[model samples]
Target: MTVQFERRTDRPDAEGRCTIHLRAYFEGQRLRLVTREKCLASEWQTDKQRFRRSKQGYQDANDYLDSLAARVQAAYRQLRTSGIEHTPEELKAALAPPAPAEKPKPEPARMLVVLFDEYRTAQSARGMRFNTLKTLNTSRNLVAEFAAKLPKGLTLAAYDMAIHDRLLGFLRHEKKLAQNSIWKVVKHIKAMLAYLNRDRGMPLAVEPKQLKAEWVDVDKVYLTAAELATLEAAKLPVGLVRTRDAFLFCCYTGLRYSDLAELREGNLHDWSGARVLRLTQAKTRTSVSIYLTGTASALLDKYLGEGLRLLQVMANQVMNRNLKEISKRAGLRELVEVGDYRNGQDGQATGAQV
Candidate 1:
């Protein structure tokens, strides 16, 4: 077997660049394979079968030709050692640059619900709050339900404007979810998708930012100072006293349920002769310092002698259920209109007693 470099001056490209080819001769057959090297017709030396010295990078070009020739020779010797009958075509094939590996058909972008679960698992591992994880689980369930209703099923690649519209329709019409509830679900979905895209390197059909939910400010529900005093004084149930105390503490300190659940005696401290509650918020992971009001301090002192946790707060769901009963027993019934808005339009207002 013999191999040599040959510049194709007969067919220069429009840019006057001649393709350098590897000419291989095996037995009596000849084969030519294109080399990646290119140069002008004047830059090639026919007799030496390499680039002229005047050519830019000529030494590198000649070295490449030598390496390619050596590779072809090594392939020929290997074929001879194997004692297999081979053609010039086989020799050329061995010398030919390998076809670019088909880019691994990019691991069929994970199914939407499956990817959501993965995101939830990652968040759980990252020590996300229990309530937040629960919310994510709910979002995953909602997505699975919506996917079940679809004809072709859901996928990250299939998430587009039409799917977005269908999801909103399913939540609003079929599931009969309220505007704020729908917003929360959509927000969770966007968050998961964004996390997958940004952290997991998953491709998204549409930008997460483009998937928008029209959020409306729901009217805040709370008790007035007089009503709060009435409930604080009128509560009588043995089981509900802890729940009421926890709720009253939240009202006094404006702490979220998550922070209230995690509150401990260590969080209470003396600062400049004033007692203060210091804690890092679970959801936002932001540190906060709050000067405890008299009522708040009293509630903390009332719970300090109890079990391990500060207030021994029940699960949020249980506490909420008990709070309703506590409110009814406390005679804190004042009808108030609960207003909700959707898509910049006023939604129906429901009346509830506080």
Candidate 2:
């Protein structure tokens, strides 16, 4: 076996210091092991296989290289004395120091709800949208409630196909959740499990694929053009006027409620002889530019003096409550049938007033 000290110029640290590696060649096989010694490329002597004498601490560094070579020679002689066949990899392993014993790690949080909260916090730190976080919170609460009903309570190790089936049954029968709502809850659970398993390197007791997120297409309800005009003309109490205007602005510009809540006067700018609203969407993190229509521009003009925010958008829950009342007064109370499917069969249809 031939052992030589090599200065690895290809691998340099941020400070431009490269490590000196010990390379061993035996029987046409080679093994490279990194040493604790480091120096600049100019400080190393290729012919001498050591740092230049001009470099400070060159004597000590060269002594370390000599010691490493002695250790390699000792290992090779020991292997030959045993009269056993060995490879370059075996010689490299024999030269390596013993690894330090690992300290015992505190047990990680294993309860399903606790893990859910931890996952939510991680996602929030990564800039998840408020609406999406709210949905995750809801899913966490639903899981907690279902766990409360279990005989032994829910733990990460206890999650399996049986638990998945029971949770679905609880949502469908006990909680009376719609098919799509159940699908969303299931989706959130799978997402949390996937994050824990793949990103955090945690072992999953149950595969997320086994927990299916089955969704059924449902008819979406929205106001017609005639209904929008009627709502615009309808007289409302002073309390509901702001909510009505905000809703109409969304209808005109197709902006999501989250984007409207965050819209500011600075977002409105003159572009190519026309006014446009430009902002990054909260959910998708995508830039959007919408040309202002006559009605949409008029609504913004009405709220011009309302601080830096273009619209005095209220909390989503309160705004939704006010919308129901406003829509009722606007004569948009046509009854509609909302149908859902379950297990590939037609399920119950519910009547809702639009």
lDDT of each: 0.79, 0.83
What is the C-alpha lDDT profile of model 1 across 239-313, one tens digit per residue?
889888887887777677777878877887898877998898775678889998888888888878787778988
- Off-target runs (Cα >4 Å) in candidate 2 are 1-109, 125-131, 145-153, 169-176, 237-239, 271-274, 314-322, 334-353
TM-score, one value per model: 0.55, 0.56
lDDT of 2 by residue, 1-354 (tens): 888998888989998989999997777878788899999888999988989977789999999899988898888888889976667777877877789989999776488988899999999999888878987898899999999988878988788898899999999999877787789899999999999999999888799988986788665565678878898999999899998898888878877677788898889999888889989877667788999988899999998986878999876657866877887887788532223334345453322334
Q: Which pairs of residues collide in candidate 2?
A: none
RMSD of 2: 20.0
Error of 1 at 251 (Å): 1.1
